[model samples]
Target: MEPSDLAGMALIAAAGPEEALAFIRAGVSSSPVLEVEMTSLLSEAGTARWPGLADALGRWRPRLPSLAPERDMGVMERLGGGLLIPEDPQWPPALDDLQLNAPIALWMRGQLPRIPEQRRCIALVGSRDSTSYGANVTGELASSLVQRGFTVVSGGAYGIDANAHRGALAAAAGGGASPSTLAVMAGGLDRFYPPGNEGLLRAIAEQGALVAEVPPGTNPTRYRFLQRNRLIAALCEVTVVVEARWRSGALNTAHHAEGLSRSVGAVPGSVYSANSAGCHRLLREGAAVCVTDAAEIAELAGSAGNNLAQEPDAATALHDGLGVEDLLLLDALPLRSATSAEKLSVVAGLGMATVLAGLGRLELMGLARRATNGWQRGAV
Candidate 1:
């Protein structure tokens, strides 16, 4: 079929199933361009032959809208690379299973990543204000999945989502051949939401894939974000929640995934943390698999033996001879930066003299550095 015809069909599909069937029936009857065999098949699938059926279908007419090719093209251009219509070979069939809520068109900005040949993609989602435990678990699971040649998918949000992407990138950097990650956005690709993740999102677009259902110039709303979560759940083989509060939007994504017959997993978190309440609820209600690592997540998705087991000696060799005080000081350092002696003393719950002695030993051993204002942990 011609691109214009495909665009028209997509517009009707976006409108909803009933209108799409109507358009298909009308197009088949009037236009020689539409194949009779194809029309008959479509009619058998959902289109109505009798007036009763037609009346039932007519109730959905309001959902259909006129096609705007120029507007669509403009939106595509604003996104940098352009759009991917259903007619495009790169469109994944998984999304077609969404029935009515599936996107009419996709606004994309990068080369579409090749879907893994054997492994199913899984989405990891959670609260934007995730805790250190949540972020660490998200990263480990995402990295494990990537190492096993599974694509990790998530919204390009902060906290858990960002950590998931970073883990995937780390796996890719470690010589994995797969696409590793994908970021689905609520808004248009003209800009990244949260702004802080602009670099990370760009890296994803380059190494993996970044997708959106909305047109450019469209800002994300609370309603749109809820709808976007559905897409993330549907597109993946499974959805995992790393962390979520009682009011988290991540639970909505999990619900949508479960409704669609997709596997759902949740990482168990601290009982005292409000951020873990949603996950705890899911576990209690039998809505999710309790996942502790990427291996467990992959197993739940029916992709077993994909995780790379860690080499045991790697950890032992690094910390085998460390003194108690030195280990305490090391544990006090944040993953991203260093701490001052005073801050380290507070964190390690040690005296200033003890922290200073430990810092001196650590600096001499090439394990830490004294910066202009503070001490930073050095690469081991």
Candidate 2:
């Protein structure tokens, strides 16, 4: 197909994805008018938005005739993903704040989550090589945030990102209208990066959404990871750093949040912990708010006196009479990944028969789910 006839993402990319203002300034708009504006942007006078616009669009002009979007779309569709441009109804208005750096289009898998308000989309980022303390804190924070009706957003990588995603999924398993989490991937949705996070990424796509700027087949390079951080920051009103060191990439995300004029929150770690140095730095520099829990995070992102997390009723009927072994088993069970009966026996300090029996009971009550991979923590 001709470049003008190309899909929204390809047309925008070829027109000038790198030069954020080129197409918008040329009045290249909605899905219906993208093709027509291809010529509009190419015309001599239309490149006046920026000095480089003319050269940028000019360079793509000849190559437009040879562009092929149909093939790409076929591949994307086979993967159950499609393109998203600013004109799309599901487009997050918060991203427009990026202004000159806004992405031309997004390659996404699954539905884009729509929180009640823009600020309801909260981002949690932190050190990739995190401590057990950091991971536990991050998971609790992420799970609590989602339970409060806010959608958690994070990069789909190791450490903090993985825990954040797992925590969100764990909350979702309880079965309510709480918003689903979103993962803005550094690479293409066609594949998961870090290799280890494949299952978590897949669950997020099935339960929430996953998005990327580049098309399918793109590798996750270091530069791309940095670029993706901007999207994570811009997509949310509040970005929280659960834990980070002096040179952690999570700090980069906090900087992007500050640059975009979004709220930044830092979770304090042990005074001498190297993993928490970056958060301390942000707090010391007064670049981030000291947020110790999900409620504080919600307050920072939400408006005055609203968007409050639903306090669990103290006298609720759920789990009123569970035995000690059941409680311990619940605590030891994982939220997303599976584990074996023997592993559960060891972790919960129960016999194999006891672990197996509890797994069966929890599974029946929707408190636990089973897979050979392991026993999953069920919602209480």
Largest lDDT belongs to which candidate? 2
Quote the positional error of residue 369 for candidate 2 in Å: 61
Quantify how close model 1 is to the true structure by its C-alpha RMSD in Å. 15.5
After superposition, the stretches of candidate 1 with alpha carbons farther than 4 Å from their true spots are 1-68, 71-80, 114-119, 177-179, 303-380
Candidate 1, residue 140: how far the Cα is off, in Å: 1.2
Candidate 2: tens digits of C-alpha lDDT, residues 1-380: 11112233334544555343345445332333544454444343233333243444455455455445677677789878888878789787887776545676688886544423567788999988989999999989988888878888999999999999888888867666454789998877888888999999988888888988877767788888898999999998899999999888999999999998899999999999999999999999999999898988988887768656566567765555678888788778889898888888998999988888887877877789876766787665
Could you give candidate 1's per-residue lDDT for residues 1-380 as a string of tens digits?
11113333433544444555556446232332333433453454454342332333344344335445578677666655677767779777887766545677677776554433323788999999989999888888888888866788899999999999988888866675554688888887877786999999988887887878876656877877888898888888889999999878999999999998888999898999999999999999999988887767767777455443443455455555779989998788665665678899999988999999988888787777877778887777
State each model's CA lDDT, in order.
Answer: 0.75, 0.78
TM-score for each model? 0.63, 0.66
Task: List the candidate 2 regions with Cα displacement exceeding 4 Å.
Answer: 1-67, 111-117, 175-179, 305-380
Report RMSD (Å) for each prediction in the order shown: 15.5, 19.2
